[model samples]
Target: MPARIFKKSWLIKSIFFISAFIILVIGGTTYKKIEDLSQSSALLTQTYKVNVELEKIFSHLKDAETGQRGFIITNDPIYLDPYNVGRENINSSYAELKVLGKDNIALQNNLRELNILIDKRMEYFEKAFRFSSVGNYNDENFKENFYNGKKLMDTIRVKIKGMIDSENELLRKRQQTYESNLKVTPMFLYMVLLLSLVLMFITYSKIIRDLKKIKAANEQLEIFKESTKQSEIIGQQGNWIWDIEESAFTYSDNLYRLLGEEPQSFTPTLDNFLNFVHPEDVEKLQKDVDKMMINEDLPFIYYRIIQKNGTIRHFKACAKLHRNLDGKKQLLGITTDITNEIEHFKTLEERNLELERNNKELSAFNYVASHDLQEPLRKIQTFLSRLEDKESSKLSETGILYIDRIKNAATRMRLLIDDLLQFSRTNKSDKAFELVDINILLENAKQDLAELISEENAIITSNKLPTINVIPFQIQQLFSNLISNSLKYKSKDRIPEIRIVYSKIKASEEPQISNPKKPYYHKITFTDNGIGFDNEYAENIFVLFNRLHNKDEYSGTGIGLSICKKIVENHQGFIFGSGKPNAGATFTIYLPFI
Candidate 1:
């Protein structure tokens, strides 16, 4: 997806560059064409002006010739006036011709020759007029001068016509050039403009396509933004951005809600945000914010903020520096409402204190049971022993039986106290776990109950056990209790055959272990052929002070199995007992493999 976006972006850039290059090329071509056209037009205008000036010069000469002829024919004062005016006009025409043909050597030379011819003709005209004024109307000199003046006038007309023809040729060529330029320029510009339009249309199409994609992307962004907002609200979180370059802040809607205000309730600013901070944390938070500005980063910071309703809540925040493609710097930050976590922590702390007090009281009770409570039981046993030894003969059978009952009660009380103390001490707190061989612990348990096993003539056999991490003493106690329990409940008709089996098994294989915490467990089963009770009392038997039989039927303290349960629990293990009346009982214990 990223690659596709990059490809699209590169394509857009290429199109833009190509379009811009095309436009520049078109502008340059048009400018060059326009410049050529302007020069052609200016040249044509100059050619026409030259032709017009040439025609004006010739017309002025013609006017002077006509005036001279009129004076030679009439010899009147009006004719002299015209002749004088014509001469003056001829001189003015010569001056104008010189100025007009200054840059044309050929035209200037022609004008100079024409000037000589006009001067000769003017001399002939003056001579004729003088002869006529002296009454030499038929004089040969006057006739010859008049004929010479006519020939000179004809030569001047021929020279002026040649100059005019040369100018007309130049004007015709310039007109052809102007017409050719006008025809070719429009076609060239039209083709160029048509190509530019095609390029423009293509560029416009690409731009419109890109715009649609951008619109789609913007819509997706808006959806994602809304999703993020909902997530923040659900998770008790909020986000913000600090544009470091612009010194601007943008807070999410939830951020405003976190501060106990409506979204966009006011302009987001450091001062405005600071107003919601608790008075005690304001200075520390300000310092942290200052550090963030300097470092462009922020570590996890904890502070308290007071809502508008005056409820104080704990908040945790952190931020990192982010730089955009344009190299603008910003700090993206997230803040979480940790008030619930703080409250939970406080509750846990109070519970811990209460637990500590309870443990102290329990320890005091254990001390009393071990020393103070046991002292009287010991005295009672001693007194009963003395009475039985020294005064049993002096008492009646009933009194002796009463003394035996008292001894039994004292012994049971001692057992119950000892069991209770062991159960209390079977807690896991402060207990160091060590890797020990389970076989060794089992052997130790058997050794502790060696005398009882011998009396029962129990056949105890076990399989090899793996080494496991556990509280050693507690596990040893657990094994001893189970072995002793089996022995105490041995069926009178059969010799107790206790089998201790060990194996590694998956928790899933054990149907009794639901929602097992560990993947594997060390399974140790003690099966015995003993006076097993009904299976109905399997769970109840593990309860403290719960007995399946009366004291007369079973010389056992119910506290023993409860202690076994507690010890197994200390090692994060489970124990189950199953039995049938007058049949073998099986006790299974599962300890976590870890």
Candidate 2:
């Protein structure tokens, strides 16, 4: 009899192993087909991206040509802005194309040739601009350059079109491949799944016949019960069931633990569970429970519970009417502890109130600085001026020197007050962004510093700047501050030469920008041949009232760069400074491509 039992067991094990092996094979096959389909779809997406980048390259070229023509016709520097910006955009697009087509040698070769052609075309644009700048539009050289640029543009268009057409053809083939895989995979999976189910059913029938004689079914039930208890503990939750017909309640083991008691420590009843609820919440919870009895359901309800140790916890509960296979109606309910969430919300509310109070204080401080403080400083300056002009002759030489000192002190104070007001204004909440020509802003800034520029004989040169979305006045202020800073720190030995260069750059290409918020940024750098500070103090220089040089050496409040930082931050941009002692400084600002 024992030998016969062993044979029966071996037969059951054999069937189970065979069924599992067949299912594993089917799963493996399905996975392979799915992977193939996914690869095909990814290839199709890559083809589309390549096409898009190619088109973008062509569009940027056209924009450059258009700008060149506009400049040729009117000889306006403003038109050159588009040309400059277009070149930057073209470079950015080409970089993206390189990354996208890194695996395709043909595409890489085409891109290389395309880049060369674009460079030649841009040279033609430069030559044309030079001729146009001198009003030589009708000259032979200008005419030849113009026609050559036109021909080059046409050639570029054909090259881009051909690349795009090639990508489109590749895309078409990939799409067909993807579609074929998509159509075949589902039918294959269905057939495999059907076969797996049949084998599983046969194995299940055999297992069931054997399990009917053993206690394995009861063991499975116990495993399920233990899994449910573990889930409730991990989730900080409890489950319960209510039998409406019998007016009985069944609580899970974790429910007792949730009440700070041992599992199964008390008989689960409606009144018994209510005993743990807080007095303030007990009444409301009783009403909800009563409604559940009548309506056979319970909407989500929030309440507080007091554990045996007197810890008050917030809870949220919900219930739904469910009928068992035995046709017994019960309310299945779950309750979760939400005390942490409630605490967090209260903390946030307090912080919000604190922020509001701080903002109000700042506003008050701004009013005082702009109005009350400036008024007294202005009066002091006015009185000092009167004293210097009228009482100078009657005063002794030492007294005259004292009066001069006071005048200088008062002038510095006035400058400090004005800078403070400007810094405060940078924090204004109402920021209006618009698409403005940065060249115009730069010109305006130069105009504001025209007298100073002329006095110092400082030479300021800049490349054509781009038109970008920015807070117009703020950007103008930023330009003014940077230019003024360079002028203020000019070297004594040589004339100050400040250069402003603009380009569009990818975030990944710039090491200073980590985890960049935008993919592209407009990088504008201010390079100056001034008495620059050490690189160690680069970040500190932008702090309000943080100056490298004493006030006696340099007439500045040190709030200028701070205001520049705030303005750039307000526009979701970044500003960085780098310098070498007694050499020069470069302040680079990156405005996002928004």
Candidate 3:
């Protein structure tokens, strides 16, 4: 109603100002200022996005140059593939920039000059490439061609940087202007609103008493009741009034609709209302009513009702109690259908319970399997050691080979059992959450691998770990598995260099590497300079029994990463791994903060 009144008043003002042309100047100024503000905001946002895209484009150009250099030095065409692809993308990107800067002639001219320079640079570089392609790899002009291209690229970068800075300055000025207009706009609008409110009050005062004298009391009551009934029906709500002293009641027809019953069946009595409630909710309903009788204000409640068809329906009831003329309390208010909302909540709850149950069952199975298998595995290892130590000379070469294979199989099985059991325990273990110092955790894991570290002459370093809410043992296992995997996958030639770091990050943006569920988390990263695998296999690496190398080449069950993933997930956190082949790997764990 207020919005409609405002619109009507604005329309009238617009017409009157058009006829007189006196207020037109002020209104035009206001409208123009608002338009400028909106346009400036939009332009500022566009410029920011353009600047980001420009930076990305620049990075791609650099990558293309790097690829070209790599291919030239090694005479490998594969390395040049990305360069050709990047060159194709760069042309389209520059075309987009031209469109973006069409409104700014100065920026467009700058870009045109940069493009000309790039053409000159590419022309010389192409000649050098042709020389190399024809087996004239010792072309004396190659160094000069590379230097010319680098200088041209540098000039292009400087021109783009200047345009970005100039646009940012323009955006800053627009923002300042926007802020000034915003401040003045509200002040002028408030003044207009104040004058309008005064005029309205004067009009109301002149006619209110006269109007009241003409309206009949019972007619007003009827109008009020009719409006209330219409509102309840339209809103899918039911209104009721309980007269405690008279032991009588009244309800809108909407109330019967809410109960899934006909109006004729509703008796407007206390027991009639109670009969509609579910048997399980009757006591709660009575208690709420009794509380209203005593306190005149019973807080809102939700309860279920059994419809005529025996279907249970949920309702949200809210009531206010007021004293009648006789000083007795009367309760009046509404019951709204909330069946859909309740059912949705129940469905979500059931899904959660189902997931929890599945996790528990998985964990229990792992524990049982590990315990049962350990006895046989221990016996096999013991027998293999005795056979190797006491009767190695008596065994034939084939027999010796069989014994070694058996030992390797037994070792692999033991590791698998251990990994599976650890994964299962994450689901069943008591979640005793506490602030864990991650720095200590990483140091502990490093210490556990001290023998391997010394043998590889590994370099290990870490930033201070944050204290976060987590299950300590699970955190330990998470760190240990990741670190061990790094060492186990190291290049046989190079010394391993590992680094652990931690930082705080928003929960939603948390790395989907592990799938964490909280709103804020500590991100711990384990980086290693080892022989990394293909990035395409990042997901497969986390699955149970997944292996990038043959078992004989890289020993152990492939369940390490899977267990680490499970532990992180159970703690409502995420873990992810990224790396280039032979460029090393980074394993990140995001554990939610308490």
Using lDDT, give the best candidate's number.
2
Best by TM-score: 1
Model 3, CA-based lDDT: 0.77
Q: How does residue 197 of candidate 2 score in lDDT? A: 82
Ranking by TM-score: 1, 2, 3
lDDT of 2: 0.89
Candidates by lDDT, descending order: 2, 1, 3
lDDT of prediction 1: 0.85
Give the per-residue lDDT of model 3 (tens digit) for 13-129: 554445345245547767887887788788778778667656766766777778777777887988887777777777877787778777878767877886776677567557657
Q: What is the Cα-based lDDT of residue 261 in candidate 1?
A: 92
Residue 157 error, candidate 1, Å? 8.8
RMSD of each: 5.2, 52.6, 52.5
Model 2, runs deviating above 4 Å: 1-228, 242-249, 286-300, 319-332, 355-359, 389-393, 428-440, 457-471, 493-495
Write down the worst ten-residue block by lDDT for model 1. Answer: 1-10
Per-residue CA lDDT of model 2 for 1-594, tens digit only, reads 323434578777877788688778778978898889888888888888888888888888888888888887887788888889999999998999999899888899999999999999989988887888799878999899889988998999899989989888888888988888888888887887788688778768766766664555567777988998899998888999988788888888887878889988999988888899999999899999889888999999999989989999999999999987557999999988888889999999999999989989987998888899889878988887898788878999999898888878878888888898889888647877899999999999999999999999999999999999988999999999999999999999989899999999999999998778999999999999999989999899999999999887888898999999999998888999999888999999999997
Worst 10 residues of 3 by lDDT: 1-10
Tens digits of lDDT, candidate 1, 1-594: 323554677776776787787778778877887887787677666556656665665565566566666765676667566567667766776786677667778878887887777778778877877887886778888788778877887787787778778877876886887788778877877787787688778767877877777788888888999999899999889899999999999999999999999999999999999999999999999999999999999999999999999999899999999986667999999999999999999999999999999999999989988899999889999999999999999999999999988988998899888888887788889999999987899999999999999998999999898999988988899889999988888888999899999999999989987878899999999999998878898899999989988888888878888988887887788999999888888988999988
Angstrom error of the Cα, residue 293, model 3: value is 5.0
